[model samples]
Target chain A: MLPFARVTVIGLGLIGSSITRAVRQYMPSVRITGHDADPQVRETAVRLQLCDDVADTPGAAVIDADLVILCVPVGAMGQVAGEIADDLPADAVLSDVGSSKETVLAAVREAAPHALFVPAHPVAGTENSGPEAGFATLFQHRWCIVTAPEGTDPLAAERVCEFWRRLGAMVETMEPAHHDRVLAVTSHLPHLIAYTIVGTASDLEEVTASEVIKYSAGGFRDFTRIAASDPTMWRDVFLSNREAVLDMLQRFTEDLTSLQRAIRWGKGDELFDLFTRTRAVRRSIIDQGQDDARPDFGRAHD
Target chain B: MLPFARVTVIGLGLIGSSITRAVRQYMPSVRITGHDADPQVRETAVRLQLCDDVADTPGAAVIDADLVILCVPVGAMGQVAGEIADDLPADAVLSDVGSSKETVLAAVREAAPHALFVPAHPVAGTENSGPEAGFATLFQHRWCIVTAPEGTDPLAAERVCEFWRRLGAMVETMEPAHHDRVLAVTSHLPHLIAYTIVGTASDLEEVTASEVIKYSAGGFRDFTRIAASDPTMWRDVFLSNREAVLDMLQRFTEDLTSLQRAIRWGKGDELFDLFTRTRAVRRSIIDQGQDDARPDFGRAHD
Candidate 1:
C-alpha cells in the first residue's frame, strides 16, 4: 500500500530530488511537491519535472502534504522546519534526511511540536550534489536509518519505514543518540579523515599538487571521492553531531598514533596484524552484498 | 624497437604476473621467464602460461635473461636480489617493482653491484594480490616512477622507461630519495591512514563489527579496500619508507587536530573551507585521468 498520497520534499538537492525520482518510479500515483531555498534549484526541479509541482517556498510545499521530508543540511533543519510550521497539516508525518539525527530531532521538535517527527537518514549517497545528480536507484539496496525518539507515534514510524522500503531501502530503527554515534564512526570520522589527508597532501612542500593528483591511484584517490562530498552538508554534519564525532575522532587519533609508533619502531608484526584483521572486514562487506567483490571497488577502466 | 628480447620476472605474484601478461600482450616477440619462491605460484604460472617458461628457482630465472624485474615484497627485495646475483647476466638491465625506491636501490646495488639496477614503482594495483589477481592492462595509462641513481647507466634507465611505456604506462624519472618523499604523501601515508581507520573501526567497543561492515557503504568501505591490500607488502612498505611515511603522518595528524578543534568549537566555516578545497584536488585527479569521475568511484551495482 502507498504510505502517503501526497509527499512534500523541501531542499531539492541530491537527496530531495532523488526521493522525488524514486517516488515517481515506485509509486507514480504519489503527488510530489518539491521546494528548494535556491531559486536556481527550484527552476531546475521544474525544468526536470522532478515533482508534480515545484514550490517556491517551504510553506507552500507542505500545506496539503501527508508526508513532509526536510532534505536540507542538518544545520538548516530548524529554520526550514520553522518556515513550514504554520502551513503543515496537523496530522502530517514530519521527517528529515539529515546526516545527524539528535540535533535535527531537537530542532524539528522545537519548530514543529505538534507534528509527528520520524527522523531518518538514508545511508546512501554519491559525492555528487544538486537536483541534476539525483537518480531513482540511488537508494536501492542501501540502508535507511529511522530515529524514533521515546514516545514517538508507532503508526507514524511504521509509515515512514514503509515509505523508505518502497523506495528500495532496508529499514532499521534506532534511538536518535545511538544513530548519531553509529554514524559518527561509519560516516563522519571517515569523511573528516579523508578531507584532512587530501588537504595535507595538497599542502606538502616536497610533493607538488600535480604529483599527488598523478599518483593518486596508489590509494589517495579513494579518499578524494569521499572528500569531494558537499562542503555545506558535511560542515553541518560535523557541527550538529559534534559530541559523537569528537568522541569517535579521539579514538581514531589514538589508533592512528599507535600505528605511527609501530611504523617508527619498525613493529612489522603490529602493522601486519592490523592490516590482516582489516582484510576480514572487507571480505565481510563484500560477502554481505554491501559492496562489490570485484577488485578496485569495481571501478571501470577506460 | 623492443626494449629487451628476453625478460625474467622473479616472485610471480600480482605485479610479476601482470608484467608477464603485459609483455605477452604488448611485446609478443619477447620471451618471458618467470619464477616464484612459492612452488604453487610457479606451478600456477606454468599452468596459466603467464610466461614462455616458469623457472623453479630465482637463480634459474635470471641466468640468461636480457632484463630482470624483481617483483616481491620490499622487505624481501634484498634477499631475492642476492639469490639471483651470481646467475644474473652481466649486461642485463636489472630492475624491481617495489613500492619504495631508496632502500630497494641500496639493496639491489649491494647484491648486484655490477648489474644495472633501475628501481621502478608502477603506481597501479587493486587490493587483490597473487598470480590470479593480475591483468595485462593493469598498468595501462598509469604512472610508473623510475628512480635511476647518480652514475647509473643512462642506456639502462632509458631501456626500463621504454619497457614500461611499451606496457602502456607513462614513465617519469626521479631520484630514489625524492621518489620516496613524494610517494610517502601520495601513496604510503594514504595506505597507512586507510589501514589505521579500518583497524580502528573493527576494534571499536561501542560499534559492533557487523555494524561497521554493514554501514561501510557510507564511507568506511573505501578504506577497507586499500587496507585489504597485501598485509606483508604494506608492512614492508611502512618499514622501508619509515622516515618519509612518519613525516607525512605527523603532518596529517596536525591537520586532523586542527579539524578536530574546528569541529569542537563549531567552526563551520573552517570545516567547509577545507572540505571545499579537497574537492578541487579530486577534480584535478579526474581531469588528469588518474581516476574515474563516476560517482562512488564507479562501483558497479549488482
Candidate 2:
C-alpha cells in the first residue's frame, strides 16, 4: 500500500528531486508535484520529468498533496510553510528534509498550525545539489530520521515513516531536540571541520592550491567531498542547529587540543591509542551497514 | 627501458605489497623480493605470490636487488635501513615510502652512506593493510613525491622516478623539507583532523557510540575511512612530521575557531563564504584528476 498517493515536493533541489525520483521508482502510480523557488530548477525538473506536475509556486504544489515535503533550507522553512499553509489539504502530512529539526519543527508548526506535521530528515545525500544531481537510489540502505514532536497525529507519523521506508530508508524516531544533538555530532561537526581544513589548506602560503589538489589522495580529498556540499544549505543547518553544533564543537575542540598537545610532546602512545579506538568505530559503522566494508570507503578502486 | 632489473620491497604492508604488485603487473621481467618483520605477513606474501621470492629478513631481501624500497613506519625507517645496510648493493638505489621525508633521508644517509638513496612517498593507499589488501593499480594516477637531498646521485634519483612512473605513478621532485611542509598541510593535517573528529564523536558522553555509527553516512563516515588507517603508521607520521603537522594544526584550529564564533553569533554569511570557497578546491581537485568527480566520491553506487 502506498503511504502517500499525491506527494508534493517543494524546493526541487537534490533532496527534493531525489524523493521525486525515488517515489517514481518505488510507486509508479503515485502522483508527484514538484516546486522550486528557482525557475531554472523548475525547468530542469520538468525537463528531467522528475515529477508528474511542476508547480510554479508552493501553494499550487501543495493544494492537493496528501503528503507535502518542504526540502528548502531550514532558515526558509517557515516562509515556505506559510506560503503553502492556506492551500494545504487538512489531511496532508507536512514533513521536511532539513538537517536540523528543532528550528524547522518550530517554524513548520507555527506556520502550518492546522496541518498534520511529521518532520523527517533522510540522512542521505551526495555533495552535489540541484534537481539534476539526484538519483532514485541515493537513500537505499540509509537512515531516515523521523522527528515527530510529542502529540503529533500517530497515523500521520506512521504514514510518514511508511513513506520513507518505501523510498528504501531505515526509519528511526527521535525528539526534535534529540535529533538536532545527534546530527550535530554526526554530521554538522564533520562538515564544519572539513570546511575549515579545506580552507586552511588553500590559504597556506607554502602549499599552492594546485599542490593541495595534486596530493589530495593522501587524505584531504575525502574532506573536500563533504566540504563541497551546498553552501546555502549548510549555512542554514549550522545556524538553525547553533546550540547543539556549538556544544559539540566545544567537545571536538577540547579533543583536538589534547591531540595537538600530544603531537607537540611527541606522545606516540597517546596518538596510537586514540587512532586505534577510532578504527573500532569505523568497524562498527561498516558492521551496521552504515558504510561499505570495502577499504578506503571503496574509493581506491576509482 | 626498465628502471631496474631487480626490485626489493621491505615491510610488506599496504605500501610495500602494493609496490610489489604494481611492479609485477607493470614490469613483468623485473625480479621482485619481499620481506616483512612479521613472519605471518611474509608467509601471506609468499602464499599470495606477491613477489618472486619472500625473504625472511631485510638484509636477505636487499642482497642482490638494484632498487630497494623501505615500506615501514617512519619511526622504524632508521632501524630497517640499518638492518639492510650491510647487504645493500653498491649500485642499488635505496628509497622509502615513508610519509615524512626529511628524517627518512637522514636515517638512510647515516645507515648506508655508500649507497645511493632517493626518498619517495607515493601519495596513495587504502585503509586496508598487508598483502591481501594490495592491488597492482593502487598507485595509478596517484602522485609520488620524490625527495633527493643535495649532492645525492642524480642518476639514482632519476631511476627511482622512472621506477615509480613504470608502476603507474606521476612523480614530482622536491626538497625533503619542502615536501614535509606541503604534505603537512595536504595529507598529514587531514589525517590528524579526521582522527581527532572520529575520536571526539566516539568519546561523546551524550551520544551513544551506536548512534554515531548508525548515522555516520551524514559525514562522519568519510572521516572514519581515513581514521581507520593503520595506527602505527599514522603514529609514526605524526611523530616524525611533528613541526609541520603542529604548524598546520594551529592554522586549522584558528580557522575552526573563527567559524565557531560565526556560528555562535549566527553570522551565516561568514559560514556561507567559507563553504563556497572550499567548493572550488574540490572542483580543482576533480579537474586535476586527483579525485573522482563522481558525487560522494563515487561511493553512492555501492
Candidate 3:
C-alpha cells in the first residue's frame, strides 16, 4: 500500500467517510484529508474523525496529493473536477466511485486533461448516507469495477487497482461502454423499476398506502430497499447515463408487458417457468457466496 | 390463549410448520397436528419437531380439531379444503394462510361451505420454504391481513384474528377483493418486477451474469432477494390472483414507460422528486415497527 501518501477524498458522504474510516484502520500512518462542498458534511467529518485534515475547498484538498478520489454523486463529478483540477499535482492517480462511467469520465477529462484518471466504481453501499453512515468493512467482499478508456497508462490503472485491493475489494477491468450496458441491466434499470413501483404505491390514498406499509411483505418491501437508496445520487446516475439506462428500460418494459399478458391469460406454465428460472440466478448468487443465508440483520438500515 | 386444543394445520411447509412452531411456543399444550401432500415435508416436520403429530391426510389432521388452519399454496387450498371438509368438526374455527384471498376463499366456499372459514395471510416469509425453516417467532411483529366476506360469522373472524395475535402479529381487516387489489400493488407487482428483472439478468451471457451477481449492489440485489422466494408458491400466487395482479402490472408498465421517457430526456429533477417521495412509505413501515432490518438473515433459510 502506497499509504496513499497525502490522499484527498472529495465529498465526505457515506462512501467518502467509509473510505476515510477504512484508510484510518488499514493505513494508520498515512496522512488523510477530506473535502466536501456542503458545510455540514465538513463539520460532521471533523466531529466524526473522518480525516486528519479537513479542507474547505477541493483545490486545497487535492494540492500535491498522490491520489484524489471524487466521491460525489454521479451528476456532480464535473463540478468537483473543475474545482480541483488546477490544484491536482502531476502523476497523481485520479479516480472516482461514481456509478456511471461515460458521464463521470467526460467531466474528469474535460477538467483534468493532464491527470492520470482511472474511473472506478466500488459496488457497495447501504441505503443510508452522510458521514455517520461510514463503516470500515463496507467495502469488504464487494467488487470494485475499473473502467479505463483505450490507451490509458497501464501503470496508473494498476496503482488504482492496488489502492482498492488494499481497501479489501475484488477488482475487475472492463471497457467503459460495457460497464454502462451491464450496469444498465443490472443496476440502472432495476432502480428505475423500484422507484416507479414505490412511487405508484406512495400515490395511493393514505389508507391504502398505510396498509401497503403495514403489510409490506406482500412484495412492496423489496422495492422499498432499492427505492431507499440516495435520491440525489440515483438521479444523477439516471440523468448522466440516460441513453443506456433508457435503452435497458425499454427492454425491461417489453419483458414486463409480456409477463403481465401471461398473468392475464392465466398462463401457469409461463409464470412457473419464469419464476423457476429466476430462482436459479438467486441460487447461483448464494453458491458463489455473493449472498448469505442470513436475513436482513446485516442491513438493518434498509 | 385457548391453548388451541387439537389444532390441525394443513400443508406442513414453511408457513404451516412455522405456525406450528409458533403455536407450540405460545400454546404448548395445543397438540398441534400437521398434514402435507409432500412426504418430504411430513418427514421434515418430524425431524424438525415442528408439529406434535403428523397426519396421513388432510381429513385425519382436521379430525376433532378446534382450529384448522390451511397452509397450502393458493391453488392447493381448494383441494385441501375438499379433502378435509367432510371430516371437520361442526364448531371448528377454520382459517387459511394463503397469499391470495379471493381465490382461496372461493375454493373454501366450494369445498367446505358449512365450515367457518376465514381467509388470512401472514405478511412474513423467507426466500426458503420448508418445515426445517420454521421458527417460533416467525410472525413476531409482522402484519397479518384477514379478509372476511359479508354474511360470514363474526366469531370465526375474531377467532382467526386472536390466533394470529397470539403468534405476535397485529391484524388488519378488509374485504377479500380489496385485499387482492392492495396486495397487487404492495406485494404482487413488486414480486413480478423482481422476477422479471432477475430473469432478464440471467439471460445475460454467462460472464456478464456472474459479474452482475458479483457486483449486485447496484440495485439488482433487491430483485434477487425477491426472485429467490419459492417458485411454486409465487407461480400459484400469480395464477390464482390473475386479474388483480395483471391490472396492477398494467399500471406499473405504464408508469415505467413514463420513467423511461424521463431518463431518456435526462430529467434529473423528475427522477429525484420521484425517488424522494418513495422513502416515506418505507419510513411508515419502520414507524409501524414491522420493518425487520436484518437483511437476509432474519427471514431466509440458512
Q: After superposition, how far is residue B267 of candidate 3 from its true place, in Å?
A: 1.6
Q: Alpha-carbon error at A18 in model 3, in Å?
A: 0.6
Top-down DockQ ranking: 1, 2, 3
- Evaluated on CA atoms against the true complex, candidate 1 attains a DockQ of 0.84
lDDT of 2 by residue, B166-206 (tens): 98899999999999999998889999988988988888787
Fnat per predicted structure, each in turn? 0.83, 0.86, 0.65
Residue A234 lDDT in model 3?
A: 92
Docking class of 2: high
DockQ of all candidate complexes: 0.84, 0.81, 0.57
Error at A256, model 1, angstroms: 1.1
On lDDT, the stronger of 1 and 3 is 1
Model 1 stretches astray by more than 4 angstroms: none
Report clashes for each candidate as comma-separated counts.
0, 0, 14
- Candidate 3 residue spans exceeding 4 A from truth: A1-3, A205-207, A295-302, B1-3, B205-207, B293-302
Poorly placed runs, candidate 2 (over 4 Å): A300-302, B300-302
DockQ of predicted candidate 2: 0.81
